[model samples]
Target: MDDNADALDPTPTRGATRTRTALRRVPFTLGFLAVVFLLGLFTGGLWSRLDRRSWYPEIAYGWPPLTEGKFWTPVTGWVFGLTPGQYLCMAILFGASVAWAEWRLGTARTVLVCASGQLAGILVASVTVGLLAHTHLAWADRLAEVRDVGFTTAAISALAAVSATLRSPWRLRVRAALMAYVAITFLFESTFADLMHLIALAVWLPLGEKLFSRTEHGFWPRTRREVRMLAFTGLLVIAAASVAVYFFPGNSLLGPTGDERGSFWSTLLTVLVIAVVADQLRKGKRWAWWATIAYGVLHVTLTLILLGVAIGTDYATTGAVTVGTGLLWAGEVALLYGGRGAFRVPLRRKITEGALTGTEPGVAVRELLARYGGSTMSWMTTWPENKYWFPADGERYVAYQRHAGTVIALTDPVGPPDLLPDTIAAFTDRCEADGLVPCLFSTTAAVADIAGELGWRSAQIAEDTIVDLPALEFKGKAWQDIRSAINKATKEGIEFRLVELADEPFAVIAQVRAISEEWVGEKGLPEMGFTLGGVEEALDPAVRVGLAIDTKGIVHGVTSWLPVYGPGDEIRGWTLDVMRRRPDGFRPVIEFLIASSCQAFKEEGAEIVSLSGAPLARSTDTADTEPIDRLLEGLGAAMEPYYGFRSLHAFKAKFQPRHEPVFLCYRDEADLPRIGIALTKAYLPEVSAKDLIALGATGH
Candidate 1:
């Protein structure tokens, strides 16, 4: 929109101010719902007639009887102060409080949070309240009044509490104390409504962070079932109103119809309908179509019967009439229409974009921003966030690309999906120190978190994967086979040497680069796990380089290894960062490099040699899932036609390496869990520390 708006992007949008951004529902739904419920009770007849001041004493002991069984006869009493009115009010308020929440948090999460907080509140209420009060609810009463199906209380609690990492070590002491307080208060008094708040915080923050943090599907606006449920409630209101007027003639409905004073019933029905409709509208539904169709049919019938009478009907006014609203309410389910916005994925595009402001621009999609500040033209040389931040020790990297403007670099996944503005700015500042082109790639969105504190292009893109050496296994049949392969390579005129940083890294790298470039030419361009920069480009202090030359001193290829079991770091998986063979002796050369890499890994005591993947190693399995077996099977099946019949598998299978399968689970894919991240090479370029961290954190 406006330039200033772009600058102020990190700030949260205030929902109550307008149509309500998904994130802004907290104040209105959480706080405003409480206010309205209280008013509804006061106005809706909780104290319909309190002329006898003595009746006021009923307030002090209300909570105890309600949670108890016998006092709530027919399961309807003991609702408010053991009155149907109170139950109706509780239902209304509770529904309102959670409807928006369910909409915001998604179905599963909203239910989980609410159910948990409700249970926590109930149990804490039971133990504490039971300890203090003599009255206890019979099993029947407990079942009816507080049936423990899902989290009604906990959902409310979660809605109230805003912290996502409730179990974070730093927040543990406080979280524990809060949980204890929730237990105590629910036991002693009915006043504490913050348990749900705490649960809300505990459950929602992480979920929200995760949902939005998904480098893929977060940030799009769309409605979910929760919204539709609220919308459907409107049609129920209309149906219920029609029935109330038809049957309860003299109760307080419209004009008297027949017999007794059923007219007052109409008044109550109208209120119910109004409450439901208002709730639905606020939940963001254009119930206009259903509302119009439904009302049109019912009104036409009513008009024919009242042809001789005078009656005024307003679409807006009639919606307030309530009748047998249950079926109508239930029918709200058919109102599932927000699919367009909810599931609409944007078409993929290059991540970098432009804004004249000094700040990094927002991305169109979460594509890995090759660590360059957006300026459409500078896409090629930009690195992803991690690479930009490779030298984590506050050193800036500068570069001057022949085509783009001055290149100053910073390292961070700085904007929207990440928001690491300050880190980005600080990183670009490094250019002054290193004297290079300044740019930043927020490997992690941390860069965007501090945007307010910096003024630079904070935004960056993500790359598929980055190769890292320093960034696992078991021996059995697999081990014996690998040993044999290594032996075979040794007999094949292959020579291996480990360079502990000082051992002439380039002498070996030059030979490897030549072979690698030649391989690149044959395989096409842009090696998946490597850059054109070669072995020297792959070296750093945290890494150890190794070279495998032929007996003639012509380095056939290169291999890197790492300490598998460091006292400080439990390193297990060793990556095959670079392996290129001379075209003339490619097969024997590959076999030698492969065997040598495994040998070096074993020498260093590595458990598994991570050969990235056959396809994209990404899969749809959670960390807790048992997928290694299935992954191995799939790899065997797919590679059978190609790599399996070729030298790649011949070499790999000889190692008898236990296949480690990876999966990718998208919120959209129905069978996502079944989708394997077949091979990292297919999905990602190379692995980086950030990818490793995300693997641990998000379990993607």
Candidate 2:
């Protein structure tokens, strides 16, 4: 036991040994950089006038070493104008640029990012370039992405991806800013830098670090999934780049004769670099600049082969072709593995809890998609339920789907283990031989656990909520307070008449939109009101509108409700959607709605009526819990502000409802980035980080 305990510890000192091992692996990277440096020096020559204005390209005869062909005349013709010293420095700079990332992530990890990032960047940039180039838009529109729509932009973009996926905070800010400046300097000053790198980084670090923190095996298949997504994305990128480059024209990309745009060395260089870079991506680096380089190679190779057959080549000029290919090979290789630890001296890694053991961002995406065509299992939108089996809140829809052989899905919060055992059995009996089984996206673990406890097979679908709405007994002091508030509203002439959804005073959709926008923005509140595809996402067919109108036909406040149900059960829920009262007296919309929903549901023989969760925006940024909680601690005592927690709790006090704590738990843990991305695309399509963090914390 003691030996096992000690082994599991892997103490700090033991962990430090790994760091030492990591440092030891630096030679591969150093050697690689050294080769680039010397060659750059050789080509740049020994000296020149010390002024800075003069700079030119040159060939380092041995740094990459010339190997073949008579294509030397044109290639050397451009290089002869440069001083050898200048060429060496430029090569050295490029090598150093490649080395920066290797120092941070550990050689293997760094190499992974470089290789994969390069392949991804190249392919993406190439396609984007090609698409923009070939579009029928005007020159201004075609060149809108950059002053020059060519492969150099693709190259920078590929590098940005490498840096974004692997660079640390400080390095990212500085390097990214520097990259932007250079890209702008060379391309279009007003462009958005073909920077897919930031996305790569966002996808890489958080997921990689989080997943890797788990036992290493949890990371394997997930990593494969990320690689797969990168591959698909790479192909898409190439198509976009192709359009951008070929259809656009700018002096920055024009190769002498502006007509030689797509035929330029720079464009070819960007595409060609892809093969070299993609070859280097290991770990996260494996997809490095793939599509971009592939496009370039295809274009250049075909052009050259056709040219050779048409015009013919002589052995004397072979040196030029060799130089061109060599410079390309060196840059591609150097940049391809251009990550922090790709060529680092090896150091033993430390295993500290919560410290990043590894990072595999978006690595889980494909694994999810492979199992399901999408990353999430939402309440709506799936063809499988029609093809498969799903239960809706409605029986007719369910019957129609079953009859039509369409997929239908449903969720049950909490009830008997066999809450739907009969339903599942019936479906199974109907489609037993075919393997199409009815699915239950359960709300409570107790419900799902029972299915498993009963020897029935099941899979976790989703998590939901239920409120234990007790009777509206006026026995308690708080319940009495709720009653009193309703009495006051009636006395003040605030009446509630339940109207059909279509008979509401204002346009339901437009009114909800205005209130929602205000709540999400200026109102310091948030809602899950289903802004898009209408309010039906969260509401049932029993929905009703309670408009608080005055004698003048003026709207004072508005509320909505519905009777929610379960097998052999039903309850009333008052949705306090929008409440704006005149200053003569603010109407207690909560009191009226609760009273209305209760009366309606009770008459229908429902046992209890739920006021529902306060639809206050709980998005992290808008949530005011911190200050309220702080007051509870008496931290830095002060005259309590009027509207803060002081007012919020006061309103809830009227209902005097029992507190039902809602906890947001995940499957061991949750993917925050995925959640954030998901939420932004959901409630607030324009949501920020605060939105995701808030949404991720949400529960019914």
Candidate 3:
């Protein structure tokens, strides 16, 4: 016990070891930057000369020394900055970028990418400045002697390089934000530093992927039509923003003259061109990619030309603003052109909304079911409340009901096992296309595992009590309650009889209906359907009905069973449903009926008997403590007194049936609330909001 206690202690040595292990796991690039920054801070101005220039000889990469001889400037300049603020900023940017890039591309490649980007950007900027100075361009002449000294360029380059390693949506969002910030900066406040940063990003973006090619595919605007719509939406936002700025008072952001005619026409032409490209891209036109790329190039070129003209004509108040405009355009160009592959999905033949909604599971669907079999709840697919979705192959199908923007499947795909995955995919894809959330309620574990692959979350709602008929016997000590109930019923001359209700006499059927009506009335709620059954489902020709009857043939209780069909239409099992007991009859009649029915099924060579599930009832698996689970627990409590679902589950436990967990599976955790509401509606479609609210007070 002392040894065990000692082992459990979080000792200082153990803590230190853990800390060291975690530190070792951190990317070396990040750790190095952190150490350097701290040391630099402690050293005060030791790294700088009296002239406010870097004390390191290799720090001059541009301006004063544009020589290729200063080969170490690209590497050594990364560690030195003009001010503490610049040093701190570089530390933060490089720390994040290098850490992420090194973690993804490893140390050697990250070093190569950063170094190459820095060298390329410095060389390009210096050469451009020299050429422009010879041409007498005032903007270039002013920038010619501006010493570029910071890690901002290389840091941004690293960021751009690491972006290609990210998955979609995130990849798209990060690249967009990075490029947008850079472009906007250059557009509104173009500086020599900004130009070099942009050059660095451009150099690094393509190189990252060439070295480490990884792709993340997901279904967002999963269809071609969605891509087209997204492009049009983008166009609208741009036009609206442009128009708002153009008409604003004292706004010379676009141009000093503020020529509304040219601006409006130019904006319209741009929108038209974008719309055309989007449509062509939707149709899988190869040239659309290049056309959009050219547009991006032209956009950046025009912005630079305008900035140069403004500077040359002396209309540019601040070179910063002109540079900002140029950078913003450049960033926009990179983002717009960098994500070319995002629109490469081959266009599928257009599926009309009418065809999607009107599709019915016909004869082929029935044949597939007979061939492949399905779950106990699969027969509920024929219920009028559900809509069936069949894949084009008609080999499998899923039934669902839509409410409150959520399309909830009643169970797993109920046809061929091989086609189950594809059927679910098709259903979810349709939901995505129509902008509806898809979910599966009361699904089996196998189906839940399949949904998990599609990134679905799950909550255990109830457990199906399946009794093994072959192993069931009334001799065990645990079977005392069931045996006593049977004995009492026998002494009272009540007989248990299983018969098809369709062949029953009119009087028997009427009595059974009266029992069902009384049960429904006692609940003070509508007759629930979906997985549950009422008198209507019990009356089906194929459903077997069990009756607790007296010697006089008067029925005291009735329980219906739906046959669980095997691959060859053989009745391998039975699912109990539509349990109704007479108000004034024998107290133990329901128990006697269930026990006797199990015995009868055993005699009939059935392998198992399912007592079905109590809706909204929970099991012992409280491992998932998500808010959705808590909310569901509260909901179950709210309706517990009225429905007694948990009580029913407890009663079903008397038989010692194996508890098979049933789950409600859904795509995306963000939609769990909507899914909860949809499940409520699916279970109690006829109950009004007021009725549900008043339920707690009435306690039926």
Candidate 4:
């Protein structure tokens, strides 16, 4: 089965159909907004402040109105806004949020949720204010006499209810943003509307899952990226709260705010500091985590002390602001502690145990690979971006990249097979000691078996396409495409040249760079790293570059090959890496280059030529795939339009090569989330959040 098929199954016609269906699905949302709009227009509340009207208090809901037997206030309140600005804001928020909820939950369910939530919020807030009115709580007492109108409470409730249907990362994000909005607004600007909003959210947030969720994934973060996002959201909420109070502070549910409670400059400085630390937290920095934890503890302890003093002395003011902020801090601390594994990246780079220190790790890795020869991907270990960990014997090493607190070993150890177990064990232990998740990517079955023996789980992530040179021929029907490509290249006078890229003249190198850059410029994301190399990697003397040039020496296409070594420093085969072609030049240039390159290598007595494993692309699927497999399948589909890894995997079938499965071996499923993030970073090391957001916006 095609694993990525389901992800890419939506056609343009199907997408248009879905869009049309969704537009028709939100009738209740449209009706609700219409009712509010028409009511405002008829009552002149859209242009003038409703409070200025003599009959406003009769329709606005609050404790005083409810106690006076104005039982119709709650229903009437939903149809009016206080002013034109409030109408506009409510229309925008309600249109977007209620429309979305209606689309996801259907019109009937949405109507039920919004109506019930509106009534519940009005009653709860009024009752709450009524209970606390004469209890000397200044904020509640002041709000008890006031009334409010709007559908904001209903809008928020609908959003919270639909949050149950969202998938991870977004599910957490929307909920956090909603909670932060209500909490911050109520604490610093406790309007009756804000109190109703908070009440609606509190009541519907947990209950929504039981009512609306079709499939419930656990609430905890499932990926390192989610953990970072949550941490960032927490810090951002803190900063937002400080900004809110500084700009619009007064008597709130949490007592006095702004200058009355703290200095303006101090609040600004605190916000700036928190903003910086929050960014670091998003990057999973260990030092930032510690700093945040300490900040949380300090706030919690101070709040406790203040509460103790108030309780002992019978003080009327309970320092409610401090207590609320302390509670927020406590939640942040709990989140940090639970996801501590995501924050193991240190403030400074530290050497792993038994890591090469005195000499260049890349040089050591290359020498070891040359001396003892490893898997098809062993040559990739020599890349400059990798770090090498040596065993006690100093003869073996594993090349890995540290990202998102994961030690992602690229392939297998480059040493004797007999020492494989020891090397794997040592690496795992070192990662454990360093508090890093350990995993191997694009590794051989031997390594997977070894990892399994050490209690690790393995899943096939890609298939390495290998063309046995001795058996390769273009004489049969299966080789029709290859033969046709070669014939076309010959007719066009496309000459093939294989040489060390770095030895080429400046003009040739420039043309090669231009071709590669043009290819990269077309991609939505930057050129990938890790197992995938580029023109720079082809510049290595040991790597060979295959060029398709016309009679006039205009380069049409280019390909790079890394030598795969066997025992005794023998060059056993070549693994293909970089492949690029001029978009306007030679339609079959890639096939021609590969076929010619294979012929050249075969003439040199090389046993096989590897097309290399296409990242996140599998040749086949298993019936009993795990959750991780499905996750990867979805990721592959999302990335297909940008990177086309699955397309490349399919194209390699033209060569009729044997497929060798490559596995990603890890300690357990718990580490898969971090591993996924680490792999993304390793592949797109230069990708920024803006780039990712843009990519996602493309719906790929």
* lDDT winner: 4
Tell me the whole-model lDDT of each prediction, alpha carbons only. 0.38, 0.36, 0.68, 0.84
Better of 1 and 3 by TM-score: 3
Which regions of candidate 2 deviate over 4 angstroms? 1-442, 451-471, 505-513, 523-541, 568-587, 613-653, 658-686, 689-700
TM-score of every model versus the real structure: 0.26, 0.32, 0.48, 0.60
Per residue, candidate 1 scores C-alpha lDDT tens digits across 591-685 of: 55655665566666555554433332232333453454354344444433322222442355544444432222111222222222322322223
Number of backbone collisions per candidate: 117, 126, 21, 0
Can you write out model 3's per-residue Cα lDDT over 541-654, one digit (the tens) per residue? 778999998988789999999877678667788889888898789898888989998999999999989898888786774446887777677777788876799899999989
Candidate order, TM-score descending: 4, 3, 2, 1
Model 1: how far residue 662 lies from native, Å: 2.3
Best by TM-score: 4
Per-model C-alpha RMSD = 27.7, 23.9, 23.3, 13.5
Return the candidate ranking by lDDT, descending: 4, 3, 1, 2
Candidate 4 C-alpha error for residue 207, in Å: 3.4
lDDT for model 1, please. 0.38
